[model samples]
Target: MAALLDSVRAFFAPKNDDAFLIDRENPSDVVARECLLDRAMGVGRRKKSSEALRRNRVPAEGLALVARDTSGHVIGTVRLWHIDAGITPEGNAVPALLLGPLAVDADHAGKGIGGALMRAAILEARKHGHGAILLVGDAPYYERFGFTTEKTATLVMPGPSARERFLALELRDGWLEGAAGVLTASGAKMLEAPLKKAA
Candidate 1:
């Protein structure tokens, strides 16, 4: 039992070499920043780039994934937000991880790196015991990865996007069977602080 626990701890422990691939603690790292910039350019739709950055910080210890090229320049990035996954309508708890800001450099868009980042994020979330993931994005693109709008029918979000746009994916079978009101506790606090300041 002791050896198993130690092995599990070592499995998720960060190594020096991880600096080249990703930095979960410091999203503002030079390579990470460049990857964000590259993605913004590639998407060519910057309407929510700033807001996305703020939300990424809204989580506790933002988990950042960075992709680098042969020359060691960061070319892609993805992030996961920690959220409450609030209680379901049936009174069951549902903890979730919110996925977002998945971006790849314009030069690296078609090379499958973005997909790799998504897979990594999902696996990591499951390993950490998260029940589900919620996000707003295309159906066709994310469908291939088992993401669906099934849970959106029960979960209520703050935004006004259509039902199809908001999606969820259960990390385990029946994970979100009766879950609802999935929102980040920290995100809610951060958002409230800004509103208070504005008032």
Candidate 2:
């Protein structure tokens, strides 16, 4: 993981020749602040208000990543959550990961930082034994990461999101074969097992 992060840092340093680093746990306030201001993205919600910001400060509370510039300024941020799968095709509860809030400062928009953050998240999920991950995003943008609508049809979420926007990626093969049912506390507990010791 260190090597992968080093590569990401190098890739982002060429422009303006600034140094870069990755924060594996919580991102600094600067990064979060800028990300919340990006109107092109849906991150400027109440969920990103000052109260929510304080709530998200705990390290390892969620899988959040941040990239910093030479002066240690936060240039980008992303986060992930473990929530219950809303529907399961086989009646058994489905446990899945949710990826979202991928935000990059306008100055850093064109860089590959967003993609690097996503790749790191997927890699981390697999390392932690997660079966699958889901997201509501543009098909073309997420397709490169193996996320597709075919494996996500049986799943449901509590929102007014478009059906076509729902997508999932099976980190392990056949993970979605019979996965069906609402997420339960037990499922959340199960997913927390791998990270418990890490914490």
Candidate 3:
């Protein structure tokens, strides 16, 4: 039991790598970001309920981020999107951000990259004055960062998601108090390019 306990503790503990640095994601990192996310989350990632909220939408300004190793290769990625995290029972839309698809390269797992990204994103959201943030993920992993299902009890995602896996973190105290309704995409839509001229 002692040996098993120690191993478990080590597994859950954050491990740091001085070689890594968190930075605002650059447009040039798209391919690297996609590969990292695919390796960490697999191809079916786009089918998740959260994808609907992110489809054809852009991440909130300055909230798209990545972690680069000393070689300048993207090893992790996270993006926060604008969402109306449901409405209040009084019928007012509660503005919030939806954090999702946070992924780290398989080779970089357990190096504290995920935690660093999470902390940076939360800080940016607070700096930008977002009221709350929501996500669907394992409670145990996210709980360490102050995410909880408590305030999300009355909220609902647009698609099917496990009740317990839906979680929220209120940046402003009581921001979610009266929040209750279906989540909907509220981010800026992707700008369309001009049609090509016929030859």
Candidate 4:
């Protein structure tokens, strides 16, 4: 029985070097992606400030991405939501993206999938002319990708959050300069609606 259990475990384990393909998330991936997130972040993830921002909204165009393994399982995911950064130095409503809940299946940890997803999300956000991104995450982990607290010092989330973990990355120079006040959802129409129909 012990040998049989070992065989099952070996078969279910993720290979450390498994090849993963990153792609734009489609409607069909919703269920699997949610399952992966639940497995990675637990059911209580909905209570976070980031979730409040993402509620009833859609991710920015081409910014919701997933990483699939060779067998086509959705193993990792990241998304960016449109948000208002209260106001800018010029007194205009500051537009930016809120990145969050970047999750990877526990079995797939340490394979650089999360990093790959971040790079993909940032590159796509820039390509789409987005100016900046905000996320509640570890400074140490996101700093490597250019996120910092310097621009986000005066920014506040709509709900409670750890001040230090709230960081920003500017896709365009000076996007967040002199920006301050509460970060709120953009309420932008879902860009994925057409894609969902096409899928």
Best by lDDT: 3
Candidate ranking under lDDT, highest first, comes to: 3, 4, 2, 1
lDDT of 3 at 56: 93
- Candidate 3's C-alpha runs over 4 A off are 1-18
Clash pairs (backbone) in predicted model 2: 87-181, 88-180, 88-181, 89-180
- Residues 81-161 of candidate 1 have per-residue lDDT tens digits of 766556767776676777776777776666666776677677667766777777778899999888999877877665445
Residues 1-199 of candidate 3 have per-residue lDDT tens digits of 2322232232232334546767778889989998887888889989999999999999998889887777788988899999997788888899999998899888877788898888878877887899999999999999998999999998898888998899999999999998888899999999988999999
Q: How accurate is candidate 2 locally (lDDT)?
A: 0.62
Local error of candidate 1 at 81, Å? 0.7
Instruction: Put down candidate 4 lDDT per residue, 137-156, tens digits, no spaces.
Output: 99999999999988899899
The predicted structure with the larger TM-score, 1 or 2, is: 2
Q: Where does candidate 2 stray beyond 4 Å?
A: 1-19, 27-62, 87-90, 181-199
Give TM per candidate: 0.68, 0.71, 0.90, 0.85
| Model 2, span 14-87: residue lDDT tens | 55654456656443464454554465455545453221222333222336667667776777666666665654
> Would you list the clashing residue pairs of candidate 4?
none
RMSD of 4: 9.6
Deviation in angstroms for 14 in model 1?
25
